[model samples]
Target: MSAVQGLIPQPSGLDREDDVLTAEGLTKTFGTRTVVDGLSLRVGAGEILGFLGPNGAGKSTAIAMLTGILPPDRGAVTIDGLPLGGRTARTAKSRIGVVPQEIALYPSLTARQNLRFFAGVQGLRGAARAERVDWALEVTGLTDRAADTVSSYSGGMQRRLNIAAGLLHRPKLVFLDEPTVGVDAQSRGLIFETVLRLRRELGMSVVYTSHYMPEVEQLCDRIVIIDRGRLLAEGTRDELVAPLGDGLLRWELPAGAPEAVRRELAAHGRVESEDTPGGTALVITAHDLARALRAVTDLAVRHRLPLTGLRLDRPDLESLFLHLTGRAIRDGS
Candidate 1:
């Protein structure tokens, strides 16, 4: 039998539960600083959970605790009803596959050779090993180039191969940390397709972390936002953003925009000004874009101030992140 046939358990028979992985009050500390402070979240079976946080928000620390790489100072992690640590730690670890942010392959080796090495570590041998290597190559769309050196593969191919290595044992849950980072558009799309396949075809739960807001917006069924090691919000995109009310209307004005104009814009809603490459931008939170646009245009015309540009940005994950953390996700990164 092929390695995928032997190693990959039939997902059709597996129980699909709402909570496949749960972390309750997970805390971690380093010397004097508590990195991950009382974190908690849940991932549903066959669901893509977007794990979001600013850099240094203890995301890495929290992930380490959940993956069994590091024990939490307080709190607990349960995977597939198996608690982490003690007799069940190994079993719990077995249920998870982690695709780290870094490339874990040896550039000198062929893609097939890398798979063989990882599969061997997982205890597959002989024909089983060969079958799994082939399966991984095929699933990652690298079968034709399986013989090629890792050094020759594009950034995206290398990333897909990284994911394939993680799936050798067919774990029920996967942790994908910035899987699409540093890859081209085509590679990003391919990675997305591969992840979707894991959920749709194999019924695997995924916890995906990324700085690219749109990727999470597109791929995740639900999102969990964290900052300073605390859970800020968790829900579908609409649920979290809807409470923040309507979107933002931004007006780009010349550097010396009149103070009167700024004060006038604030009367419509919460107005924030920042220096941009183009000019000074006034971002106004508005319930009605049409009225806000008319008001701004009228004010600009009355003041005879040059209006450089106007843009209406609908509420999105990025906006939600900003609303919750008071910082742009990218800026935090």
Candidate 2:
């Protein structure tokens, strides 16, 4: 019943349950260009907040601010109730982990060595460090290859090692930026499986950023969509998908349609796509796809333009993202 009780599943390996982090009015800029505008978001204990946006849309900038890697020109970010504006940020960051888009490891070092170095940097040493190191290697399925040089490891193995390094500290909040980017299918599945295990075992609160929509759709507990340096919306899959206006009704019209006929068809739906070879594909969002289809059919017959194709698109996260951004997730931000 608490505000923080937002679908957090009961899990093991968590010591004390607590809200992991929050960001309010978070903003950043360089000269005249603002990369991340004022934005507010929340990540609960043991929750994964999927951060989604296109290129240049400030996804990375927001991550930088949230992790304290880059100071914000405005607003604030806090972790474990520690303010992001000062020394508290540093201390707070020690309890957090980051899996960068690029694998963060020494190419010449073995996976175990790299993990050990990070654990040491986190101030872990001796028995505790060794325990954590072995646990992380095992969890990420890198134990057998732990002695392999990072440069000699396959891309997928290297990625697993990168995550292993992050887990060595057992951070309360982990920032995963494109962690599975460019990895093979098997490795990607392992990465997601590892995330699930971590969430259950550690009750770890995580922030994930990725261009892969299906991955986000499947893995994240919730999503925050941003575009052009500003937040478009934030909520769980249903909450965000619910307000995507309506389902899509696409109708393919005959070729070389005149303006008057086009205008008539346009009344039934928005002209979403068109091609001379493929005719005009019109899209109208409506709760009743059937009724909308009938209306379009009337228009087609009235104008004598061929109504060749039609389909109903159910509302979904991908559709939601597209509705807000006016572009596909893969489109440039």
Candidate 3:
């Protein structure tokens, strides 16, 4: 059994209900501008829900509201059926672990000391505290370095320790905001493995927010895309990408490629043109890949437009983001 599995008992009875978190009509505004508007979401137990949005998309505001750090202008949030505020809110908050985008830790403290302090804050004490501190170290692969001060650790090691600190008390749900930021490939892989173990071994629910498309695509069971204070789409990757037809076919043409050629390619599928450093590029969302390729090649030959470069790409989360938000996720960030 994993360290998490060995530490926490299996949840039963009412805890088995799938919906671990529910937010209804959440809205947040600052001054004259509304940041998060009428946002609602649901995350089931043991599920990793990817929260995606471009910069200034109100992703931060929405997370604050959901975590009860900021009160929403309108809406209600409940964790494990416990509403936000009053005694119930405390109870609800106690069951949550939040690992922020920035590392929140005492640089002077050793890894074990940090976990012990955080665990105490969560009400773990005596033998329980010691056990949890040990478990956090073991699960995060920091057991050997438990005595070393956090300031001496590398960026990735500090990030791992941050996660270990949050898991000290073994909260039922976790909010990981860009946890893998600034880490190397090995550390990123370790973080991914740890997250997978959280759900697989301990049945913990996770709310993951990141600008990286591939991480969301690989880790999340379902994804929600939000932009300009509104939700654009929410579903599994396959479900969201299905409506864009098949894959994308892209061609590079000499600058000022004839408008007639553009129109002709549009006849094949949905076409969008952009001026690039090399030349003008035409992208076609193809329903029939074979037919679209043949038509484009034949047209290029007839028009005497040399095909500088050509590539066919399968539909993915990045494509879906571009289609829905009208811009690349990285560009906005």
Answer with 2 or 3, whichever has the higher TM-score. Answer: 3
lDDT of 2 at 80: 86
Question: How would you encode candidate 2's per-residue C-alpha lDDT over 1-333 as one tens digit per residue?
Answer: 211112222122212336687777778888898888887777888999899987778888888888888888888777888886676867888878998888778999988899889999888989999999999999999899888899999898888898988888888899888888889999999999999988999899889988888898899998888887777776777666553335676667666766675565455444455454666666565655566677767767777766558666677777666656767877873
lDDT score for candidate 2 against the true structure: 0.77
Q: How does candidate 3 fare on TM-score?
A: 0.84
The lDDT for every candidate, in the order shown, is 0.84, 0.77, 0.83
TM-score of each: 0.82, 0.83, 0.84
Count of steric clashes across candidates, in order: 0, 0, 0
Higher-lDDT candidate among 2 and 3?
A: 3
Write candidate 1's Cα lDDT for 1-333 as tens digits.
211112222112123356789888888888999888988788888999999988878888899998999999999999999998889999999999999999999999999999999999998999999998898888778899999999999889999999999999889899999999999999999899999999988999999999999999899998888788887777787776664447778788886767888887777767767687856888787767677888988988897866668877778888767756667776655
Task: Output the worst ten-in-a-row residue range by lDDT, candidate 2.
Answer: 1-10
Give residue 149's lDDT in candidate 3 (0 to 100). Answer: 97
TM-score: model 2 vs. ground truth: 0.83
Badly placed stretches (over 4 Å) of model 1 are 1-17, 249-284, 296-312
Compare the candidates by TM-score and give the number of the best one.
Answer: 3
